[model samples]
Every structure is written in C-alpha cells, then in structure tokens.
Target: MKQNLDLAPVGNCSVSALIDRCGRYVWACAPRVDGDPVFSALMDGDDPEHGFWEVCLADLKDVEQAYIKNTPVLRTVLTDTNGSAVEIIDFAPRHHKHHRTYRPVAFGRIIRPISGAPRICVRLRPSADWGARRAEATSGSNHIRYHCTDLTLRLTTDCPVSHILEERTFRLETPLAFFLGPDEGYDQEVGPGVAATLDRTVVYWKDWVRTLYIPLDFQDAVIRAAITLKLCAYEETGAIVAAMTTSVPEFPESGRNWDYRFCWIRDAYYTVRALNRLGAVDILENYLVYLRNLVDNSAGGHIQPVYGVGLEADLSERIVDSVEGYRGMKPVRVGNQAHEHLQHDVYGQIVLPLVQSFYDQRLIRPGSVEDFCALEAVGDRAYALHDQPDAGLWEFRTIARVHTYSSVMCWAACDRLAKAADALGLADRAEVWSQRADTIRARVEAEAYIPEEGRFGASFGGRELDASLLQLVDLGFLDPMDPRQVATFNAIERDLKKGPYLFRYVEPDDFGEPETAFNFCTFWFIEALHLNGRTAEAREIFEQMLSRRTHAGLLSEDIALGTDELWGNYPQTYSLVGIINCAVLLSRSWTDVR
Candidate 1:
C-alpha cells in the first residue's frame, strides 16, 4: 500500500493536523476588525469540497516547505507532475516598520514566484460567509475582476494568464500574479507585482522580526507565536488584537463563541509584556504611546474592555445562525457582546500595560491632566470593592463567581497605581493606593488561600481550582516556592490535569459544551510545574504538548482527546505565547520543576 500523504495547513508539528476527509489547505480572511467576516472556518468546519483555497494532492506530495530564516516569508516548493519544480513565496509588504491601526485600511500585499519555469495554475474564489455569495468574474488582458455584492477583487500579475476562467468557471496556469494595493497607482489598474515586490516583503518581515530581543530558548511553536503576534499587531495603532478571528468556537457543536479580532485592553497587557520579553520593546513602547494618546483623549471614559482594530469603540453582535460551526460548533456570533459587559477587571488589565511600559523602557509620555484622571478614575474603581465578586479573568456570561483570580488582578490594579504614582512623585495619593493594595493583599491571603485544603481556590470560599491563579509568577505576589504557590500548583495538577492536557478550570464552563483541553491552561501548567521544581515533569509534558501540533506547527484553542483533532480557535496568540515562554524558561533549567 502507498504511504498516506497529508498536507498539513499549520505545518508546525505532525500530530495536530486538522485533516479534512480530503484535507488539502485552509483559508483565513478576517475583515476590518469591527466588520463582518469575509471568510470563517470558525463559523463552519472545513468543507474541503467548497473551500476558498483548494489544494491538489500532487501539490502535497511534491511540495517542500520552509520560511525565509528569521522572517515570515512563507516559501513553498512545488514540483509539477511534468517533472519540474517551482518556488512560491508570499508576504505582505508595508511602508511602515510598525503599523498602529486607528482606522481600517487596505494592506500592502504581494505573492512572488521564483525559480523553476513550470507552468503554474491558480484559482481566486473570494467568498462571503462560507461561499454564500457567488462573485462575478470578468477577464482583462492583465487582470481578473471578481465582483460580489459591494465587494470587488481584481487579481493582476506579471505572470501570464493562460487558461483563464471566471468566478465559478475560472482557473489558470500563469507564471505570476499581483494583488493591487489601490487602483490609484496602477495604469488601467497596475500596482505591485510578483517579480517587482518580492524583495520589499522579504525585507519588511525579516527586519521587523529582527528587532525582537527574545530572552529564552525558542522552539518552532514559540517562534511562530512571536511571529503571529507581529502579524496581529496593527501597524497604524500599537493595539494588538487578541486573536485573528471572530466566531471560532472553543468547542464545535456548541453555541459558545465570540469575536477575537479586536484589541482588548485586558489581553493587550499580556501581549505587550510577552512581546517585550522577546526584546521587541518597540511594540509595547509604541502601544503605550497609543494608550497614552487614548488616555489623554476625552473619550477615554468610554473605554470598553476591547476595541475595534481601527479604534472604533462601537461593537455589536449579529447571529449568523444559518452557517454551521467549525467542526460543528454553532449559531455563530460575529461581534463581541462582552464589549457591553461592565467588567470591573478592566481597570487592572489596562493598568498593567501602563505600569510595565514605564518599568521596562522608562517610556512615560509627557503626562497630562487627562492621563492623571484616567489613572485616578481606574484607581478609584479599584478601591471600591477589592474583595467583592465581579467578572473574573475568564469573563463567563453567567452569574459572577467570587473569582480569586479577578480579586488578585484587582489587587494588582491598586498595587501598580501606587507604584506608578510613587515613581512619578504623586506622593499624597500613594498612601491611599498603597492602603488599597494592602487591603486586597490581606483579603487574598485571608480568604483566598485555604490552609486546611493546603491550596488556593479559584474563587473566594470555593473548592474549585483554576489554572489562571498560576499567573502569580508574573505578578510578584507569590514566590513559586511558597507553600501556597506549590500547593496551588499541585492542586491544579491534580484537578485540571487529564493525561497530558489541562483544563481551564475544574468548575463548570458555560461555553455550552466541554471543549478540547484549553490551550493556555496547558502552557500555564507547564510554567507552574517548571517554576514549582517539577521541571522534569514539566519538560516531559511540554515535549508531549508540542508533539500534537499540525504539520505547520499551528494549534487551536482546544484539542479533541479521542482523535486529537485541533479544535477551538485557530492560531491562538496566548497559547503560542504560553508554549514559547515555557520553552524559553525550560531551556534554561527544568531543575526547579525537576
């Protein structure tokens, strides 16, 4: 029998390949942040029969893949059945080194074919909501026009268009193609092409990534996460999106899903620090610059936990129930409703990036009354009820639990406020914030840590455990060696651990169904185990976790246990970061966890 050949989309590891029945390639296209999706696998699972990008089996067997070292230049080597090979490289070249997205704009993109003179065939089928609308295709000597609804796509290239077919009927074997930036510069629609713009994209990605100062050992996935982070960061505004998609379910058959393409102030804190740890000080610093700008603006009080990629604070959801789920998770939601939730934790989440940028780079912009007011306002919110139940870090839609994690972060908000104020000479207010911070700390120690149980609870006076509490390593509240820290870590290992995987929490998750093991929780476990002197165990589990990635090293938020299918949202930033941070930490020593 012939050995089975699989074309892995995420191409990082061998095991996590999300193989369709006739799996070939996957498609990803997220519209302007607040805009509705143009393409979504999260809305419906892989339907290779009607996918946007079709992969030929011959392309799988004959193709070799690698990135241009130190950059995101995706290079693929394809050998035609006629016994000739071709090299194709893809990347989007931008004028600015770092883009800070404030308003949505078209990206500067290009794809170049280099090497072997084999005839190439390509198809451009741009879909709206799972091939819902049929685009009209018209041919020009140098371009192909595809129009659907209000959206129009024109494909132009230096490559010759030999066998041209239209929207539903077009297919071609050409040597090159150019995706225009704007109609303005093209003569009868001429812009950048494959041959002329290759070098530009190559230099852009490599140079931007070269600026990173990564501190720990980077594995394939860790490096990939760092690169993914770069991709999600809008060059126009320093805001980094939490993920690259909307409506991708954590579990496929459930109605539990939310949009992740927006810049979340809470998530942004982790993003900046993680990026900073890699030595990309510019991302956080510039992002801080953007935040300072927001802080100074009068509309800062209208702050939501998240914002559109363009900084348009307006966010609403639509139910596209007609579409199916990715692997069958459903009733797809397009906008984020959490945008309207009164998340008190927002105060701490925003404060972290502020305090970190100040500490990591001494990057305090010229302070103004507005900045002071934003800080004071957030600080005022912090002092109101450090010990009370509010939406925790998980942001569950049901009744609020007395989440210890939320309370810890609440304490963090007050602590950072006092720290920043004292550092900058707000001496009088320092005591007030200091007292507030102390009160939260006392509350956590008194009510959060349970001595009889020899462990910390996920919420106040609760018996359940959550992986999030492991975050104290980053917060400085608890040393990894402390008994409660060790106890908490051990407790997590006992409850959250299932084989090699970890759950987000041991409690009931309201996401409509149980998901494949949570991705970030797994990484957090590795970090906890490693920090608590379980390095050997952490290393074993870390190595095991890495083994599950698809051929391209891509991962989803959850993974199915039965078939080990890559489930949840695709290419989660936090998951990638967690894996990377753990790999880096372990590369130094597993003796602590050993």
Candidate 2:
C-alpha cells in the first residue's frame, strides 16, 4: 500500500497516536508527546512488520473508518470475504476524576463482533530506539508486557494472552477490551472499565464542544477542526505541537520534511487564537501560563522559534538512521535545528498572544501592570531588531534577509504594547511604544515597498513575492483596499498560486524549490480574497480547499499541487487553524437563521 495521510488521531492532550485506515496504531510516542515513538510504523517505511499494533481479520475484503460524532474517538470496521465483520473502537482515556481532569498516557481499544463470526489475528509489535529493535515481550495469563530501553508498556486485555502473544488467529465469540498503559496492574475489570472510560470520553468531548461559539455554517467542519487543534495541545505544559508525526515529507522524495513534534511560538499562537475565536478560553488560559514561564525564563532575552513541550531549550537536530523515513526516504530527524536560528517574528508572536490577556476581562487572572512591564522588554527587542536580517517565518535554512513579514510582526509587537499601555493608564509607556511602532512602519514602507512594481517586496529592496505578504491586512499593517496591498496580493496570486492552492514562495531555498503548496497559505489567500470583496470567488476557493481535506476532515502542512494529495505532517495545527479561521470568516451570519 502506498504511504498516505489517510489517518485519524486519538488523544487526551497528554499523549496521542495515529491510526491508519486498517485500524493499525501506526505512530504513538510514550511518556509524552515528544518522547520515544514506541509505535513507530509511520516512519518505518521499509520494514512494516514491527513498530505497529494491529488487529488483522482473516480474508479481509473491505474496511471503513470514521470518528465517532464530536469526539476524537475513531471507529474502524473490517469486513471479511465471508461477511464476518468486526468494529474496532479506539480512543485515549480522558475525563474528569478526583479533583482534576484524568488524562493518562494510555490507549483504549474495544473489539466488538458486529456481524457474523470473524476470525482475527492480533499483531502487537512496538519498537524502541527509533525502530532499531523490537520490544521484548513477557506474557501473563491475561496481560502482556513489552519492554523497551527506556519505556515498558503493559497491554491489559480481556482477550486470551496466548492468542495475542502467539499472533494466533481465533474466532470471535464476544467483545474484548484492551488497555495499553504504564507497567502496572489493572485495578478494575478490563472490559467494564474500558467501556465506562469510553462513555465518559464521549461525554467529555461532546460537553466541551457545547461550549464553543462556532459559526452557523460549516458547523461540522469547524467543530472537527476545533477538536483537532485542541488535541495538538499538551495540557501538561500548555504547549501545542505543530503536528503529530515527523519525517512525513512535504512531497515524495523532496527531503522537505522537518520534525514538528515540538512547540513553535508562531504555530501555538495561531492555535490559541483560533480556539479563542471559538470561546474556548481554557486553552488560552493554560497556554498563557506556558507563555508566562517562557517570558519569565527569557527575562527579555532571545527566544527560539520552537522548544520542547516541557520548555527544554536545547533541541539539537540529529538523524535517526535505523528507521526508514516515510516511503523509504532516508534521514528521519529527531530534534529541529530552527531553534538556533534568529526568527525575529517570534518576538511579535509572543507579544501578540499576550495582548489578549490584558484586554479580555473573562480570564480568571487578567493581565496586570506587572505583566505589561515584562512584555515591554520583548517590545524593546522587536524595536531594536525590526530592520535586522534573520531567518524569516518560513525559516529559510541557507539565507537571511530583512523579510517584510518579520518586520511587520515587529511593528505589531510595539503597536499592541502601546494599546496595552493605554489600557493600563500608562500614558508615558503608550507614547514610547506608539513612537516605536511608527518608526518601524516608516522603515518598512521606505525599504520594503517597490515604487516601480507598485507592491511591497518580500524583503527590503528585493523583488521576490511571498504568501506571508498577504497578511499585511490581517496584521493591521495595511488596509484591505490599500492600492499597494492590493497590488502585492495580485502579484503574489499571479506568481505563487497554482489552481486552488498557494505556495509559500517559488524561490528555491535550502531544499530545492518547494514542490507542494502550503495549506496555510491557501487559506490566507482565501481570507484575502474575501476581504477584497471577492466573496464569491473566495467561497469557491474555500470549498475547493475543504474538498481536499482527508477523510477525517483534516489537512497537513503541504498539498501536492498537481494531485491534491496531502504530503506533510499529519493533522497539522496550522492547517486546522486555517479551517476554523476561514469558516468563521466565510460562514453566513447567525441572524440568517430567521
């Protein structure tokens, strides 16, 4: 089978996994989101026998998969040639318990025979050391323990241990429940406990969805996007991952893959903003705590573009050669090297999200003057480096230029800090920041704008076009109808747009020119089209983008322009944020209900 992104994700914000169409647990990390990939089949392209957990139906004929309603719970039904079928319901247990939310680093699977008697084989193979070796197994009467170098996982199931250990085929007689968790004994009956956990998990998701203020139109799409974005968040530390799995190339053999399992300030800001639009303030509140820690730790110094979920700073990149990459591509990388690059927009991304805490009265602990004072230090760096060259938001590995988008973000930092100062009755600080914003705006207009081309260049005195320029209006840097902004948008569309998708840029970077269209940029184009009064065209393009989503109504970082194939990491938070943002932008007004 060709490697594809036709997968669904299940998690409780603590740990997550990717399940393929055939109900195999293809990828999951142990201990935490950034931990070892105990189930590493997603990255093991050459040898698929190990590093995965699957239930194989004898003589399999057809397979069907879908998420249960509003939850991340996935249900896959496999039908055999003889009409025997079985339903595999998979979810990670998450609900309220004791005095707090009970989300464990565990997976729950309930196997139910829904039709004729089905004979199935259980294949539970997990690897350690990045697929260098299969996990050693020890079995008991009802459970089996898989031991890896750094982690040990226990599979507590009601099924016969012999059938699982021997990978023996057996006739389905009754439902079976499996709980894969820490190396501990099961306190409750496996079947009953898992069933109860499933019930509560469903209720928990449904109740959470009820709290969202979604748009009237595309409610289903919006909810799914919202839930997927929520799943990307690591609640333990309030850091949101960019995507689930790593080393999934942007395009086949393109070598454009980068590990996105850690938290990027830019990506998390977008995720938190999208959820905040849905009135989901809890995520924002928790993320604020994470941000505060980052700010406090930095003490107004340099901040990396990305960090580990636990706020670890040194993310030195290394290649894991044991496992073949997606589709046998080499060099499955672990840590991201972007941490060392000077992505100046991070200064603004940090401050932009903090602006909400000062203005929003709903937060339990609203921003105080102390918070504003600390953020001013970030604003100082933004002002000082607004014109300096660094790796832009795209993180071009081999080049450095004073990108307009980065400068615009720096301007936003100062501008928002001015507003926050005004809100706090600090007139002196407000004037200081306002002056800094004006100075950056003047420099950007003078250097980034091309008078002959009647548009803003991607960088100072450069003529290249970038999709990030389309955010001129979104970031409050330019008016939607400004003639310069319009010309820039049209120039970008003429050069970078292919069919219904948009490329981040056409220029070749560290890798050769990007072969796939960026999903987030396409959405930005959709929003721009809408803002420019091309609502009809914008809606048409938005529908086209939506049609390109996977079966689970999710998108990756990049799409093959010619084939409309998702080609990047799985369930990208950036793409999910696009769905929510565009839905809210294009949906009909709620008053239309009358």
**Candidate 1 residue lDDT tens string, 548-594:** 76555656677666666665555666777676677777885435445
- Looking at candidate 1, the ten consecutive residues that score lowest on lDDT are 11-20
lDDT of 1 at 294: 55
Q: For residues 1-594, could you state the per-residue lDDT of candidate 2 as single tens digits?
A: 556788899999999999988999889997887788998888888458789999999999999999999999999999999999999999999999998999998999999999999999989999888888899999888899999657799999999999988899999889999999989999999999999999999999999999999999989899999998889999999999999988899888888778999999999999999999999999999999889899999988998999999999999999989888888986688989999999999999999999999999999999999999998889999999999999999999889999999999999999999999999999999999999999999999999999998999999989999999998899999999999999999999899999888999999999988888999999999999999999999999999988988888999999996778888888999999999999999999999988
Reference-based TM-score, model 1: 0.84
Predictions in order: lDDT? 0.60, 0.93
Q: Highest TM-score: which candidate?
A: 2
Residue 579 lDDT, candidate 1, scale 0-100: 68
Could you tell me the lDDT of residue 364 within candidate 1? 44
Model 1 residue runs over 4 Å out of place are 1-34, 39-61, 95-120, 129-131, 148-151, 159-162, 166-174, 185-193, 293-303, 360-373, 511-513, 589-594
- In model 1, what lDDT does residue 160 have? 51
